[model samples]
Target: MRFIAAFAVFLFHLTMLSIHTPHGIDVLHQFKDEGVREAYNSVFHIAGFTGVSFFFALSGFVLTWSARSTDTLTGFWRRRFFKIYPLHIVTYAAGLLLLTGSAFRASDDLPGVFLLQSWIPDARVIFAANSPSWSISCEALFYVLFPLLLPLIERIPASRLWWWSAAMVAGIFAVATIGHLYVSMEYQFWFTYTLPPLRLMEFVLGIFAARLVILGRWPDIRLAPATVLLVLAYALALQLPQVYAQTAVTIVPVVLLVGAGATADIEGRSRLLRSRTMVWLGEISFAFYMVHLVVLLSARKWLGAEDSYSTPKALLVIAGCLAVTMVLAWLLHIGVERPAMRHWSVRRQDRDRGRTTASV
Candidate 1:
């Protein structure tokens, strides 16, 4: 599911590149007929953005699901830092090397390098090298608060978790509404969309949903129905104005879909998402997400912007980039992510040994 979401984001970026034209001369204009363009826009324009939402929610779900009762907050933080930062720093440097002449800005690079770019509302900093990493800033905030947040969440009665979930849903809509009515378009895009604090609500919703599932209180909706709801919500988002669409219009379905997936896993029912291929892809999904934009930007630099490609040529470019990205992602997962986790996530070693002794 995560790999699929990342690929959706990759496709969205490709589409954005293809349509962007400077001086009224789009290179892709020659190949894209009006009908094709309109179809592409209608189907893909907003759908890709939802991938980020999926990720935010999934982070909450997975962290909550795997959290150990005995784990300390510092232990969790250490594991998370080692898990994400090693690859992040490596890819951040890669982005700088590949895009130095173009999108790279020294002033923006400082914040980006430290994963603090999303703290501010500046587009230059928010979208600096490895632009997709803005979400990492938000993730960092969630990690900082997770230790504090989890205790509060655990204190809530199982039966009351659904009410908390409901409140989260209300908060999402409320933020969306307020942003639409009160915030300027510029502030709305940066503050509402990219700010870590605002995005924390989505993460909290994930945590709340996970608590419900842990308590056996999650709704009984099956995976199929939950998935259908997700698709329908995405479709509805397409019809909405850009402001609401870009906000949390589909958050309800997202939370439901995540809850359903967790339910499926706990029930031990086989699902496509658990297949070997998907499992491998999901394992490498984070690396793929980190490196794909750099791959895309490099490809564009070499082959000219995506607008330069004809329809068939663009298809080839997308295919090629996808292949290269997967290869690189696999390498990074093995080379950086795994090794760092093995070496730096040392706090859990005693716990693991204790578990082994008890089981024996």
Candidate 2:
């Protein structure tokens, strides 16, 4: 599911760049007919941004689901840092190397390198050095707060968790409505779209949903129906005004899907998500998400500064870039991510020692 969501974001980026930039092969505009182009945009373009929302929710759910009672806050932080930063640093450097001569700025570089870029309102800063990594900034905020938040979350009585979840959802809707009505368009984009604090609500909801399931208080919502609700909500979101659309419109469905997946796992019912191929892909999904934009942008640069290509050629380019991105992602997962987690992550040495003692 994470892999699928990451790929959706990748597709969204590709289509968006095709529409806005002159550097890439314009995949969407390849169709000469206006109607075909509009149809393509209508179907493929609107829903891709929801992938990020999926990720935010999934992060909360997965982290909460796997959290150990004995785990220390420092230990959790160390593990998360090791899990994400190595890949982020590598990709950030790669993006810098690729954009060497193109509008690079020292001001943006500082925040970007430290994963603080999202704090700034400027898109150039927020999207600096690996544009996709701005989300990491948000994730960092979530990680920092998780230890503090979890104890409070666990304190909520299981019976009342549903109401608590509802309250959070209501809060999200309220924030969205206020932002839509009161905030200016420019600031609204910063506040509702890129701001880490605002985005933290989705993460919080994820935590809440997971706690409900942990207590066996999760609503008895099946995976299929939850999935259907997600699709419907996403479609309805697309029809909404841009302000509301960019807000928490699909948050309810996202939470439901995450909760449903968790329930599926706990019940030991076999699902497509547990399949080996998907499991592998999900493992590398973070790396894939980190590297894909650079891969696409580099491909565009290599394609000789052309503004657009014929439909077949543009599609070929997109396919080729995706292939290369996946290969690089797999290599990064094996080389950088796996090794770092094994050696540098929390309690690896202790775990190994325990295993040795057990074998003896």
Q: Which stretches of candidate 1 lie over 4 Å from their true place?
A: 17-31, 102-104, 347-360
Error of 1 at 1 (Å): 1.3
Off by over 4 Å in 2: 18-34, 100-102, 347-352
Q: After superposition, how far is residue 225 of candidate 2 from its true place, in Å?
A: 1.4
Best by TM-score: 2
Give the TM-score comparing model 1 with the true structure, all chains together. 0.91
CA displacement after TM-score superposition, residue 223 of candidate 2 (Å): 1.8
Model 1 C-alpha RMSD vs. true structure (Å) is 3.2
- For 22-81, candidate 2 gives per-residue lDDT tens digits of 223354554445565566677667565688888998999889989998998888999999
How close is every model to the real structure, measured as TM-score?
0.91, 0.92
**Residue pairs clashing, model 1:** 28-307
Q: Give residue 330's error in model 1 in angstroms.
A: 0.7
C-alpha-based local distance difference test score of model 1? 0.80
- Compared with the true structure, the alpha-carbon lDDT of candidate 2 equals 0.81
